[model samples]
Target: MTFQYIAQRFERSGSGSDSFKALFKSAFDLMKEDTANASLYFLIAVAAKSYVRTYEDQAVTEEVAERAKTILCGYNTRVLEALAAEPAARYAIGSGIAYDYEWQVADF
Candidate 1:
């Protein structure tokens, strides 16, 4: 699923009550589907991190943040493994120069 679709799902999943938990559950459920696209996990990680950051001004218990971090780390490791198994390729821009591209896992 696309990031926008994930965002819509998050909105419908009642994120306000327990934002981090809801995000974690959503990501966990999606991961259980066993989608082969690594980008979906990356998007989920981005969405979860972005949602969690929105609570910076509020009182986010350390335990909640740590729990979410742990789950996210596991998902990231899977993404890295998926990327490693894919072949390296090149992409051509509008200028016609083909540049080599590789997927790099970003730490949250």
Candidate 2:
């Protein structure tokens, strides 16, 4: 499925923080289990944390959050950097809010 579909699904049906976390978990699982949208999944993983950090009372545990960070820091720095460099590509990989939030993360 496209990132747009995922975003729409989340907004329409993912009513709470737990639902957001579940979406993140699904993205993480897809990242491990498939290769088609690794960049997209990475974007979702990071955006999930950002969303929780701001609006949600339910935060992703530090361990899971750190693991996601470590994966990016250790293994996918180039992936994130490359995606960040292109505005359109980043948008294509994420929905509006996700694109904005996750693109900010790619700079670091």
Candidate 3:
């Protein structure tokens, strides 16, 4: 799956980037080496890092930043595995090119 896909999913989940970054940090030391698990974690790591940039929070440690990238790359093969699983269910139509779809369907 693309960054957009995971971003869309979590973004639509109404999760904060701070939450995502913290979750990834907490989960970082414990992710399984198994391909699927690793891949999802990698997605989470990358998403956490990328999403953090959009926030107004104070800068994170270079250590944290490096750790995020390292964890994601350690599972590179797994990340690629996830990337092969599916595409974005929907595409965005405007700026940022970020995934912004609503996860729930509602009668309007």
Maximum-TM-score candidate: 2
Q: Which regions of candidate 1 deviate over 4 angstroms?
A: 1-45, 86-108
Model 2 TM-score is 0.45
The CA root-mean-square deviation of candidate 1, after full C-alpha superposition on the true structure, stands at: 11.1
lDDT by residue (tens digit), candidate 2, 47-80: 6655565546644565654544443332233334
- What pairs collide in candidate 1? none
lDDT of 2: 0.52
Clashing pairs in 3: 1-82, 1-83
* Tens-digit lDDT track of model 3 for 1-106: 4343443344343344455565455335334534434435544564455546644275655555455444333333344444455534111111111221122111
Of the two candidates 1 and 2, the one with more favorable TM-score, higher being better, is 2
> Considering every candidate listed, which one attains the maximal lDDT?
2
Q: lDDT tens digits, residues 1-108, model 1?
A: 443344445445432426555655566566656455434454545546554566645775666556545544444443444444533321112011111111322222
Rank all candidate structures by their TM-score, best first, as comma-separated numbers. Answer: 2, 1, 3
Pick out the ten consecutive residues of candidate 2 with the lowest summed lDDT: 71-80
Candidate 2: misplaced stretches above 4 Å? 1-9, 58-99, 102-108
